[model samples]
Target chain A: SQTIHQWPATLVQPVGSPLSLECTVEGTSNPNLYWYRQAAGRGLQLLFYSVGIGQISSEVPQNLSASRPQDRQFILSSKKLLLSDSGFYLCAWSVSSGLYNEQFFGPGTRLTVL
Target chain B: SQQGEEDPQALSIQEGENATMNCSYKTSINNLQWYRQNSGRGLVHLILIRSNEREKHSGRLRVTLDTSKKSSSLLITASRAADTASYFCATDESGGSYIPTFGRGTSLIVHP
Candidate 1:
């Protein structure tokens, strides 16, 4: 079975601080990875997605960026955090290639920028 | 703007009562997916219904899709307190893009 993992389950950082969150998937290769942020009691906003290693796609212009260093390893980073960046950060993977498929998500990280 | 919108932003019902949630989308889609999220947790994929298919069943869950209406509904039978969470509907475009757009979600609360 495939499993997705995320680190720093919870984080509290001061404003303007750098941010780095990691996501790794075991038992799957060349999977589509995505980064999403959800505000309190709201829907997900697609931040980034990657089709393969070294390839990243940004859905909305924001303070965050994503990178896929390895086939199953994806990282979401920011040079400086903003108050608006506080939200539930999620990582998901899907077996899709321009085809509709179900996505599997990780436990997620709760980031609070104070 | 959100591509999908869920009806009855929030719902409360007693255990054993059936809970139904509806979703309306704005454009053509290849498939519609349902996901469940416990409080402060990541979402769990529940079911997916292709545009070509009208209905699908998974254990205690039933999903219905109407391409003409550009809408879908999820039915949870004999709901339990554990079902107290948010349900989100996601739709993928029929075009060449594969990214799925999600709605705000319907918060369901099932009293034990």
Candidate 2:
């Protein structure tokens, strides 16, 4: 039983506008996708990660960008938006290469770059 | 410049008392996770100690690891109030490069 979904839980862009956040994983099937960010007090900021479909692995480097295309879909992009980019946006999942690789999160997305 | 470092950034227990948090990291690790956030939501995988293993629990949470002095500690028993939140300590790096390196958390405030 695996389930991780994220959407526009809350967002308010402006700085330069243009950002899209979306993550999906139901019942798991080649999971292993992540993209964390929580700056306000700092901590938890691993940008992007994926282990399949197109494969992406960026740790940190500004504006933000990530994509996984299929295999459970995972995306988090941005073309502008910067006010430090805002924060609190997670979306994780594990169990793709197996072996006790704990990591399951979702239900987050609170951007506010104005 | 953070491979993990959480030590008394904030804490104010009271619900049932018993909340300890401490973490220190620098290099050489194979595992050391513990997360739980509930202020902005997300993050909730609390317990993963394996640097050759030192301690690990779940139900009431109890983790301890000290690969020499890399440090790690998280003990929250009897505490409630939804367990307040904010507690992180990650560091998985033993060459395999599994990706995990977070710190700067420890804001538990369970005062009911």
Candidate 3:
């Protein structure tokens, strides 16, 4: 069985501060990793996705960026956060075999930029 | 714009009753997936239906996909209070791209 872990389950950061959120998956190698953000009472928006280490494709342009430092480790970071950057950030993984595979998500991180 | 849109943004029903949610998408797709999310929690994948397939079942849940209409329906039979959650539909666009685009979701509340 595979498990995904994310931390600082909840975070409060002041505007203009640096941000870092980490996601790690165990029991899976070379999995496709993705980063998504959801606003209050809204649907999720894909921010970035990675096919392999050091390879990331961003879906939307904003204050955030993603990196795949290791095969099973993905990090979402920002040099300076903005108030609009506050949202529920999610990490997901899927098999790289097919184009239509189901994604497994982590618990998620709640970010509040005040 | 969102590729997929769920109907009836919110629904409330009594436990033991059947719950049905609909999703409509625009564009060719290789597959459609359904996911459930508890309040303040990450989403859990429920089921996936390929474009070539019409219907699929898992436990008490049934999903039907109509490729011609570009729509899908998810049916939960004998719903329970624990089944209260937001359901989202995602589409895997045709072509080799493996990304799945998600909709806003339909919030379902099952009263016990």
Lowest-lDDT window of 10 residues in candidate 2 chain A? A93-102
DockQ of 2: 0.28
- For each of the candidates, what fraction of the native contacts does it recover? 0.72, 0.72, 0.77
Give the chain A TM-score for each candidate: 0.97, 0.33, 0.98
Chain B TM-score against the true chain B, each candidate:
0.98, 0.34, 0.98
Please list the residue runs of candidate 3 whose C-alpha ends up more than 4 Å from where it truly belongs after superposition: none
Candidate 3 at B16: error in angstroms?
0.9
Every model's Cα RMSD, please? 0.8, 14.4, 0.8
Candidate closer to the true structure by lDDT (higher is better), 1 or 2: 1
Q: Go through the candidates in order and give each one's DockQ.
A: 0.80, 0.28, 0.82
Give one digit per residue, the lDDT tens place, for model 1 in B1-112.
5888998799999999999999999899998999999998999999989999999999999999999999999999999998999999999888836688899999999999
lDDT of 3 by residue, B40-69 (tens): 999999999999999999999999999999
Better of 1 and 2 by TM-score: 1
Off by over 4 Å in 1: none
Error of 2 at B91 (Å): 6.2
